[model samples]
Target: MEDGLLSLKWNNHKITFFEILRVLREKANYTDATIAVEGKFYPVHKLVMSTCSEYFSEIFERTPCKSPVIVLKDVRSQDMDALLDYMYLGEVNVNQNDLASLLKTAECLRIKGLAVPDEDPTKFRKGQSDDRRESPPPKRRRHEDSSSQPLSQRPVSPTISASSKTTPPSRTPPLQHQTSSLPVSQSQDSVHDSIVDPPPMVKVEMEEADDPDDGYSRRDNSYDGGSVNEGDGDFGTELSKSEHDPDNYGSGSFPGPSIQPGGDLPWDEGDSSSFPPEGFSGDLPAGQQPQGAEGLELGWLGGNEAFRCHLCTVSCGSSTQLQRHVMTHTGEKPFSCHYCSHRTARKYNLKIHLRDVHGVPIDRRFARY
Candidate 1:
């Protein structure tokens, strides 16, 4: 839907229906099949891609290569599950308020590289010369130092080693370095007053030291060779005992209803505060159990609400989608690939991706970026 609501007072400014229709009809974006999924149709009066999302259609059209399989051999199934989430929702929503690992399955799966700004190459790396960029050449140096120099005593062209009219001999003697240091009292106070170490010299070096460990902790630096908490005595015994102790009062009780501990059943939705115990016998109902236990019991919902990925023997939240994804490996070429860098998953998208990114001819329908 068009987010803009066109409004105006009739006597103040009345908009004609024809003008509205003209704007809707004449907009180049009204051309068919840009935003809608293929084999699906859209209303001519429907707002254009740009009317709602500026780059939506452009990103959709990008193309990649034609590798029929996505071999994420090294990735875990749980991470693959998250990637599957994007297939259905088009984006992943992650928890930000708590400490939970944001897991994205590393897909050697030739399906598609994430097509978004956060994943772009330029963003992943920063500019090389940003370090060398000079700060606005000290403001005081511009306004104070040069201007404050004594006008009467400053270097002048009239002071000559030899007069210009008398041409020196061809064999001129090499001039000695004769730049006499200016007296401290006569020196520009602004320069001397401002001369101090720049923060960047130290800051840049420190940043360079941290560059290697952005991804990995090669050595145990969290607890450096010395103690982690130097001043405080090591109360490892008490800290460990408290940190690992489970809150026993929070367990074995059901919410608003009597539930067999560890029993696999639906908890009463009416109340969810009191949860079951950790060592309790039966599988507790999901809601009445621990707050975080619900996600791990993931089931694949598929064709006829079946919860199994028959092709992969895996489970997904949506069975139909899972089925369709499995077909990608059968050389269906549902997404065309442009064979420049790597393969793309969808055929039509490859055309758009190639045109926008590589400036390549769209004739080869399989290319993807």
Candidate 2:
């Protein structure tokens, strides 16, 4: 074999890539013969043949004399160059895009066999798909994780990736949350007594004004994911006041005990209470603390930072002070076109911009490949 040429001998079959290259160089029968397999057809260039499975055998047998042979669907379409490389060298990685195509092509060409197929193809598909997904199996997860985690926590999500060419999702995370709101009432029923006997048509109660500060439209709070004790809480203002300020005994200062230190705990009560060396010293003093100390703890302030990096989420003492400081090294290109720049990180974003806004020449290259 020449330095760049490849050769292979299997049983009585002999194939040298140099032969095909010489034919191509001479333009002498270089064009592969075409043959139909199942619903599709492809050009078969070399005659090196093999029989592994029935489906493949049928396709291989049907290929006209000069047709080229492919490995699997995984290689034929997307990895055309790799397939060509394999045609010469007989090896390549089977990437996802061309896997099915290479397999289909191989099946068409009978690179495997026409019969003697696996008994349970569903198991085979499930195994391969499961492996490709690399997600925790439902049964394999801990009981809590299995019941609590969403399908996305596994190797894949319930829905396919938006960029996928087909219905079955690709390896990317299903990130976009598409919330579908349901109609409040099945019938066109108003808030009033739309019961058997309609109330008087006079408007009795004034309409409640929508609060500008509270912009979020109230969702149905009665959901499975809602807080278990949302409406009722044992530790209300009474418990909070007692815990934060134990100084107020039962003086007629007010209906409820006066808030001594005032305000609630920073962390959850259980977590904060755990550090109480003696647990609730319960010492109340004459309602007087030092200046700038009411509703504030000397333990806090200047000890540590509060606000964190908006992007990195690291702790920041003061966001205002950090604003210009953040520009020191983050090096993020803050300025960008509003439309396509945010949609993708690729420079070909201009293609999307042109297609979407300017009605310029459109190309589907980035849409998939």
Candidate 3:
């Protein structure tokens, strides 16, 4: 244990020392010698120069001079500067033109670790130049040529030309094709058939034969059970026994088949009066009632046909619509103005109030409504 060897390591010591030497060389500090190249004197450290180059080491060893000013003949100042940088920092940057001169100077100075250039330095350079000249140029692509030209100046492609030159297929008109495919007689017959087509007839089947003079219909008899007599004649009964019965009409006056005003009954035929009134009694048939708050009659909306509001008798197209309608009667202010206590049953109405009363910008979400 007493004779054991110890090794301490500083990984960056080489680089750090090089950096210090470089700084010292730049400042001309601790330089014990001078290197004169091309009439330019560079202060240099003998120890550093001798350590890097054997020629300098031999000169120093032979002369035993403390501080010698070495005169370098046939060497460039720029080359000397590069060599000095190499000696200090272990790296030198020389371009292709100056690299040959730098290498020659380095060889003459016997600078260690400086790579020697090839005997014929131009061979590789000549080969590179020749390769660049001899290598085939990239083939001109069709698309590249077309793209290089202005769009209007570009030549029309063969595909486009062929398409342009080629004529489109001639096609028969639909009516002509249909008619031509059939025989001439058949074509005329079809035309005649279309022109002579009969109007659709809706036959009204009844349990008893009806007299046009009497206003009674199957609908009236369906609701009034005791009014129609059993002796009523159907199409299957004897013609002689098919007698008109006045008692067949309800005991109460016939009432002339009263039609509720402002009712959208099937028989109303889009009459202006059929459009619902402001607040009409919806005491109408199932298919005749007005929708929304105008109709407060819920009895006809039963039988799962229409959605009737519980809060009011207004029938809606759907449950969601009915829920919205019920809000009116319930006075539910589901939507409220953020700026004030004003509230509304509908989002559209709220938007209107905000725009008209509050002067607030309508939210983008409510803009559509």
Candidate 4:
């Protein structure tokens, strides 16, 4: 027997990360530190700041203060907010006019993974190969840190070093806010590149029909084993072509396929009354179409369903849609709320439930419902 190591990337990693960031931004719970920039206080997670910025990392490691308020001077509120956005999310946007200030703030805080205005903008794109992003600069000692104020008292003037920067200030209401929306005058492609991973390319092979003059080409309707992720039982099975056959219309207990426009279906040319002509049963194997069935492939119906659920009479228009739906019958829900016992078969439903029931912000990755 051979032993091997295996790694699995969670499909909802992005969602989970965004959810945690949402909690932090909302100051929902577990926040242990505050940062004051330009007199605007922001409640923040110390661990998150330490992990993202060496400046915060040094301050937390050297100082033994509880719930300390770090005063960051010479930084605008919007600039700090932009840095927070980049730290929590993977990107940030600032107006071209303010780009220099944002970059200076990023440099001051020693935040990596952000491109300078003069650098190749793609350097900070999310899908880049390196996980650690840019290399960290060498550590240097600062004399200004020794002359800083004590952590027990608030300083009238901000200190330049980590040791003197942390202190307790009178608690004030943090400005209620989401991420700062600094308008970018850059090209759409650059903004998109910085924020989103490039969409995966799908290779679709087209096949000519048995009759070349049929005026319709069939997409490779093969079942992709990869489509249904392994170890996810709630993903269910794909819908079958027979389930959506036009011939099945009015022939059985199943509903008719929605007739879309511009389709030259065999039934469209001939009398609709003679759809399931003679003794033809509407039932067929998963990927096999009914005999003599001719029409343009329903691309929207997942091209052709190559899998079928053995448990139910319910039919779905698309393969992935049916797979997600089948879990409702099996009582298998992979998506569960972090705050409650609410479980949902679909991730989108789980997100909606979180936003509506638990007050968590809607994930920016998902379209607003």
Candidate 5:
């Protein structure tokens, strides 16, 4: 068998080269070309610009000059700067106000990978009906009979005609038994006496049933007839003991087999002992410091010590400040606006953009860490 060595690869050298070129452009070192926009000159490398942009390459080939200074018109200086940044770094900082102009500029210049998708006009218009018509109308409840109409919409029943109607028969009989039993004068005298004098009051005590199944027999506050059954067993004893004991009121405990914390209680997976006491310092063990301590300690700004970025020479007093500063280089935006396509590296910046640009109300839901 022939023995051969295998090699595993990780890093991309192309990206590293582009990052170095970006650093060189940012530092304005070794620049061979100049882009003049709005009375401002940005130093840039001609080879990098020509290779990245077709417009630049064509312009340079057609018009060769002693001094490689190209003047731009009708383009904001900031947009030009962002375009150059994207050409070198492969990323651009896009916002709501400048996105349209920058996209237009990129399209005009025939820049690759910077075009925005066209939005449908109907999506932003009001009172526009959907063309798909996919949703069916809501089902309505109706009477089972085909001829029956809803009560509200049904025609009123025809009134009885006086000519064809027959009178209903009298419901009352002669009442012979009542007349024979009670004389007319005696009944009248009795009714007159009752009206003159009110009836006497009678006391009637309500008796509760002895049955255990009867709900009224069991009272939460007091027992019926001041007695409890012996057959109730331990339940009655526990109830009485808990009712009379002040400490047991509202306490979720029973007389026998009570649960004890730290013994039978559910075990927490977190290491509670590792946490420092209330007054103790938050210092960790040797070589065991927290991974994102810089970002987490942004609120403690009294000390105000500086922390430097690993990729750049920018130094920030807090981790949060450093993280926000690093986004300018990496172009990583995690926070986004709900109403628009605006995004920012820090949440507060997104909130400010929403409030100032879009007239959105400041709410706690938009709070940035």
Candidate 6:
């Protein structure tokens, strides 16, 4: 128990350390060194890298350069990215396609715990074949076996045969037998008797009997069809229709609230109250402007702050702009020019390229600014 507890504690500490490293790498928090590979820079912590990799530690010790930028050669950017990811997360996704390159990179860096065992692929395939040969074939189902045989050859239970012989074969009774017991009324209303006596009386009694709330003699008021109150100017019909139709929940019609051109939304018109007064500059005299306005826009309490891009040194006024700028570094060009093979990172850039280079009119679909 003591040994198990110590093992558990050590495992927990290792997991916690990996989690801290992953967070630091993801957020680029307190990153002192940058690894430049294939024109892409990956920010990493020097202490973690030095402690984890002896090659990195030796390079840092031997080099006299003050800058923390280290350039890698021959190694693919994706493999280096995967290496860094494994170093931080303690686990990485490796497949047959990338396995060779990953192993080479790991061996070069002297990264521990990534050595592949010397096992032959043909031996594994032979073992699988031997196992398959030793396994027994699946047994056929009893029903299927019986179905494959002739009827005379198939076995039948004595009890089933006896029951089938005793039971009468099902057949539709003649109409004459059903009406023979009833006396035929020889009167002027004979047509009505023939039409109503056969099935209508039984159907009416069954429908009336199904209503448990009321007795069989009482009529169903809930049914709008064939009811005397149905002529009450379509109110019941409208109510029933509305209850059954899912689209007409509260009212029979669904109309969204009318939104006028520019005044319906608060954001449509810019809020002038949040901005400084007209012709008011920060460099002007303090007495010329409002008293509290100077420090209001300068301090952290003000909402005039901007989100800065961590990949590059560019700062943006909004998160959307910063995200668009980060995509340039990520090399994700989702928008492509329609006329030519030109592609751009932003939709607006694609539109501008199409208008200027391709001499094509910018359609409304690609006119996002």
| Predictions: Cα RMSD each | 36.5, 34.3, 51.9, 30.0, 45.4, 40.0
Backbone atom clashes (below 3 Å) for every candidate: 48, 34, 0, 0, 0, 0
Q: Could you tell me every candidate's TM-score relative to the true structure?
A: 0.16, 0.19, 0.31, 0.33, 0.29, 0.29
Worst 10 residues of 4 by lDDT: 246-255
Best candidate, lDDT: 4
Candidate 4 or 3, higher TM-score: 4
Estimate the TM-score for candidate 6. 0.29
Candidate 1: lDDT over CA atoms? Answer: 0.22
The number of the candidate with the highest TM-score is 4
Compared with the true structure, all predictions reach lDDT values of 0.22, 0.23, 0.35, 0.35, 0.32, 0.32
Q: Comparing 3 and 5 by lDDT, which wins?
A: 3
Model 4 vs. true fold: TM? 0.33
Tally clashes: model 5.
0
C-alpha lDDT (0 to 100) for residue 306 of candidate 4? 36
Question: Lowest lDDT 10-mer window, candidate 6?
Answer: 154-163
Residue by residue across 188-228, what tens digits does model 1's lDDT show? 12122222223222111101111121111112111001100
Q: Model 6, which residues run further than 4 Å from truth? A: 1-11, 65-67, 115-369
